[model samples]
Target chain A: MTAPAAAPPFHRPGDLGEALRLLAAHPEAVPVAGGTDLMVAVNYRLTRPAAMLDLTRIGELRAWSDAGDAIRIGSGVPYTRIVAELATVLPGLAAAARTVGSPQIRNRGTLGGNLATASPAGDGHPPLLATGADIEIASTRGTRTVPVAAFFTGPKRSVLQPGELITSVIVPKAAGPQQFLKVGTRNAMVIAVCSLAVALDLETRRLGTGIGSAGPTPLTAPEADLIELPWTRPGLFNDALAEEFGRRVAAAARPIDDVRGTAAYRRHALAVCAARALRRVWTAAHGTESTR
Target chain B: MKVEMRIDGEAAVADVDRPGESLLSTLRDRLGLYGTKNACEQGECGSCTVLLDGDPVCSCLVATAQCEGREVKTVVGAVPRPVRDAFIACGAVQCGFCTPGLLVSVADLLAREGDPRDPVIREALAGNLCRCTGYEKIIDAVHAAAEAMADEAHRAPARSRAAGSTEETP
Candidate 1:
């Protein structure tokens, strides 16, 4: 038997400036916050970066602050904190965060890590997409904000360039009731086979829907604006409108068959999830029993 | 590379060469704290659960370097006596592979909660996977431990009052 290979070296930066400088200097270094996803990949030998930049020690990246119209959540903030602290301000995000793996996984999984991973099945994406969130990225060169819609270029890929690090995510406060629903193999510790998030912006009379694990990347319904529902009158939401909305959401999906589920099954699940999420949000907004 | 941290209330330093080495590996291989079992190196199994700064996390996913200056509590030194006794009394140990993680997870839950219901206990231990005993005995162990701990807490104040009265009479 031969000896095991040594693990790669890691640089733990104390501050954001140091982290950015290190990233700028060493483009080959991969920045890891919670390490829930990245560590798994490293262990499986899927990725072999020359060095790892542990970002958990940076206090600036672990904070959440209230911006003028949006709430800024640091990338290093774990899902546990998001569920506990931001439930009232970002209910949809909190709901999505609660559905992530187990309590232990949530304790260490970070929002930034999830966004960085850009998995099609990522639980964080659908909610962020529905909320029209922005990803704040920083580099020694400068800082830039990209809309979440344009962030993911493909599966397990993001628009983040070399030497750039995701600093925080900016999500606008909910304009109305929001709900997230997911279909998985089990209740807990299961990746989403298909997920849907519905957000009703009453003030703007707009309904936003995001579908996950059903396509190449987390996607918002292109016909979101076309699916009209009576926001003020709950009784006006009929099964016809709900079914149409679900069909439109499912039509936007470009899913493929995989071991977890079939493409047809994923499309069916997305339709059901979308309809159910809309019904739940409608009921909550109207203080009535869910029609479904 | 050298990583230093407090494990089970004792300062420990391990010469971990690789950044990818988990805290669980260091605890078992270097410090000889085999109480924290290693079943799934991934975070799925939860067999290598440990308390990092009082938060229950998967030791297998946590890097040893991340524990620098942080406090870690493994099952060997950190599990309370009542929890251990309750496990044996309730016959929660089967293969014992998942017992350590379950004990640590349950201990954390019991410490923070007053008297959680059955559903809460089940949810708390959902991460831990036990191949033997089918989890009924383990749930019983947690319930039994909570009852015993609550009983002890109730008796402590009464015992203190009794002692105070005796001293006054003398």
Candidate 2:
């Protein structure tokens, strides 16, 4: 592995001001929280920032709060924290967080890093997208909250500008009965070939779905509108509707074959996750979401 | 950067150049605690497992800077006598490469859970992949160790009572 060039003078910024100042001075510098994803990039020579701003020490981005209707998750909060702290309020996100890498990865990998990397296959994306979450981005100038749906521009690309940092992701507590499922080469510590996150609101009888790793960005399946799912069938999902869901989910993905799995496999996996996700929603509608 | 970490209850200081530098590097190269083997510099292998503040994490993925001012227990200092004896009795040590890490992980689990089931033990050792022995003996050793520890805990009060009576007579 190509070692990161003696990380241009380590600077431990004390506060947001110091952090912005450092970022402004070093335009090519990278901001890292958890350092799980960035370290891999640095090692692989995929990313070479002139300097790195260690955000783990920053107090502002490490605090989480459940304020009224929405729950705000600090970008610095680790996956382990998601499982341990927010699982009850945010089960979908917690379940997705648990599936990220192993216990060690879950301990160090943060939702912020996952979002910043913006991999379509990122475990956190679909869940956040389904929640209609908003990301708070801060820089020296000011802070602005962008809807999670508009956060991604393309594959591994985000709307975030230089010198900007994601402070927190705000998700609504009353989203619905949410579920996240992913198909990987292995059960753990493997990247997702295809993944699905779906949420159903019994109060409104509405369903929202998000598909990942099958497209440039996570696709919000218009299952409720474009596809005629037998929502009234109750308990049993019609095979046609299920197949239609799978087909729509596959159509939404733009996967390219790689060593991890082929494009065909990814497409099939996307269909499977989409079908399983529909069944999961049906089951939750009837009883409870089973533990994996 | 100068990082201060507690290795086996002793304070250690080392200067690392980058944020991605692994704890395994510092332990093996700088602190000379070679017991924590480095494998799959990525976290896919458990050869670098170590207890960071009592939780088992892959040392290769942990930034040495993160461990600054934190307690780090490597395999060399983490394994207890009972755990070692159980491994010997169960013939769990095979190939000798993966033993230290596996032992450290199991020890941490047992210390936390008292007596872990086979599945719990398997999950604890999931990251630490063993090519030899097929993991049967290692799992058996962990089960044996937990039972042994539980028996000792049960008898401790009785032994103390006997000692108290003897002292009173004297």
TM-score for each predicted model, relative to the true structure: 0.94, 0.88
Q: Which residue runs does candidate 1 get wrong by more than 4 Å? A: A1-8, A288-290, B158-170
What is the number of backbone collisions in each predicted candidate, taken in the order shown?
Answer: 0, 2
What TM-score results for chain B in every one of the models? 0.91, 0.88
* CA deviation > 4 Å runs, candidate 2: A1-8, A14-17, A44-50, A223-237, A287-292, B157-170
Model 2, A219: alpha-carbon shift in Å?
Answer: 2.6
Cα lDDT of candidate 1 equals: 0.87
Q: Going through the candidates in order, what fraction of the true interface contacts does each contain? A: 0.46, 0.18
Q: What is the lDDT of residue A52 in candidate 2?
A: 65
Q: DockQ for every model, please.
A: 0.55, 0.38
Candidate 1 on A1-292: residue-level lDDT in tens?
A: 5887653477889999999998887777788877788777766777775777899999999999999878999999999999999998888999999988888899999999999999999999998999899999999999999999999989989998889999999998898899889898777888899998888887787887778998899998979547867756777887777788889999999899998999999989888878888887887777766577
Residue A43, model 2, lDDT:
51
